[model samples]
Target: MVWAFHTDEPEFCPQCGDSLETQSTEDGPRPHCANCRTTAYHNSGVMARTAVVDTDRVLLIERGAAGDVGAWATPGGYIDAGEPPREAAVRELEEETGLEAAPEALTPVNVGFLEFDGGESDVAVNYAVLRSETAGTVEAGSDAADARWWTRDALRADLPAEKNNLRAIGMETLLDLLDDRS
Candidate 1:
């Protein structure tokens, strides 16, 4: 997706708005706003995620509502204001999957950037990794329709074709980590 900066119009200076023009720079294209003499861009929202892997199977939550409904995704959600991402990740894991997790058990896995709807407002940062066995019984609530553990093959077969914000744990990465534990 194209990442463009923006700024408010002259009359609406100081308020957030689209940029008027794009100027090329060494870094890349940036929006230049004479009104505030600053650059404008939408900072990707930070989301906390946890990949709960048990044995050779990984847990996936089926979304029940908007923003990728019926798609299998990792346990996570947007970090609330003033809350740390790690804490948010753990909280979301438990709330959505009914799995209590310690903050340290969740290792940083990968960060993916995805743009949707023609970049109207497409930006997200996903922080995740394999979680410890401390995670409790699986529960389905909030925006999840169901929760289940799937093998790599099962996941590939079950995943929907159209998934916008779906975040699935990498099978190879999980397998490597599990092998290390063994």
Candidate 2:
């Protein structure tokens, strides 16, 4: 299925100073530059989420800003251009939680559609990571306000009530994956 996450409205054409017209494409209706006949396609962003666990506890981060502020989520972010999802997972894990992990070490768990505010949607690629070696070094960094280990009970108790937010990043699915692995 087509993932609808972000939208862009181009009033004028970048190539020319003409107004953009609406045109339907395979993906969806997009803005078309009349002067240059260029269509501006807004594609969905891809995010990498990892369920990093240490023994019986899973690592969660409290978001500092943007969507889901103060809500707990797996350490993840948008995948950079030209970077693989696994590599992005590793990079985001380190950036958000200060946990060093290898790309090959992350195990693919699930793929789900996440819808955010502003009509943005993302294809969330979830993974299960169990690298106990770096568990002790995890500290909140980057976009995270705080990072901590939580038992399943604590996690279930503390997550936000918004089911859409939780499903967007496959938080519940990740928790289930952690349980299955354990």
Candidate 3:
């Protein structure tokens, strides 16, 4: 489930320091400002993507950013404002890994919350399966250093060099979700 933090207080908006009306009760506090037509807290929506693979191995890419740098992750990113989750998944997969993938369906996988320095983070929704009639070559692009497929055991065993703390979450959850399908 997604959580939202809304407030009308000037603190919420960097541009406008307008006074925000606060509603307080047993449910806690919520801020709404009519003039700004904004809430104090923003709701970060779900980011969905597919875990594409070749043979028994799954694909992963090294992140280019200092955050999670050198960390291995499936080629995926945030769902766009209007686009569907599946489309976003395919687009991200192609952009990051340079491999075209057609996602079959949403295979639910659990992703834990990640806390990063500088307060930047996202809620990730990952899928277990996607297919490609022709497996094209992979080249790293965008925010990726390298792209390659690794067997499940191999991927799990070499976790130290992979910077992302969520790698284990992604691998284990994808495996469990795929098991449900079979």
Candidate 4:
């Protein structure tokens, strides 16, 4: 998700210095501003992942940011407000892997959730596209440290059997995307 989960509750309202109190809303419990009467709703941030496939290999990028630094994952990121998730997926793909693609050229593979140890979470939409059409050589860009094509065998051997990699949806989605190419 694009939003970070806060482990602690807010003691003050964002709009005013008054203390924040819990109020019931249609969306459930939320923080209410005592002075401004403003209500805060918690929402999950949407994210997308692009699986660029070449033969039996899939493009993977090493994360450069903290939390998962140097760990490999599909090229993707949080969707910007007013932007479609597919477009965000393509944009992230191009930014991280230098592979240009369009929304229609990409196909949705799966949707999943990623939860962090600090209570942060994201709703991830996964996509895949054949590499024959996309242009430009693959290179690490944006916040990625590196980008490379990993064969299915290599992924299975390198990634842990447990759900611990940066792929977000785990290795099952990776295997499914690879199998779909057959």
- How high is each candidate's TM-score? 0.67, 0.83, 0.69, 0.84
The better candidate by lDDT, 1 or 4, is 4
Report model 4's TM-score to 2 decimal places.
0.84
Tens digits of per-residue lDDT for model 3 on 1-182? Answer: 22253221234433366666775645576565557655554444456655764556667788876456788777777777778777787788778878775655445456545444444456777665544432567889888888777666776677565464445345567555445433
Query: In model 3, which regions exceed 4 Å deviation?
Result: 1-27, 105-121, 130-135, 165-169, 175-182
Clashing residue pairs found in predicted model 2:
5-120, 5-121
Model 1, 1-182: lDDT tens digits are 23333222232223445344565677776565555555545455566777776666777788887667877777787777788878898888888888887776767776655555534332233444454546578888788888888776676576656742353344455445445543
lDDT of each: 0.63, 0.76, 0.62, 0.80
Lowest-scoring 10 consecutive residues by lDDT in candidate 4? 1-10
Q: After superposition, how far is residue 89 of candidate 3 from its true place, in Å?
A: 0.3
Q: Higher TM-score: candidate 1 or 4? A: 4
- Tens digit of lDDT per residue, candidate 4, span 1-182? 12222345566766667887999887778777778887665556678998888878888988888578768888999998889999999899999999999799988888888777655667899888899868899999999999998888888787554423554656877777778775
TM-score of 2: 0.83
What shift in Å separates residue 79 of candidate 2 from its native position after superposition? 0.8
Q: lDDT: which candidate is best? A: 4
Q: What value does the lDDT take at residue 58 in candidate 1? A: 73
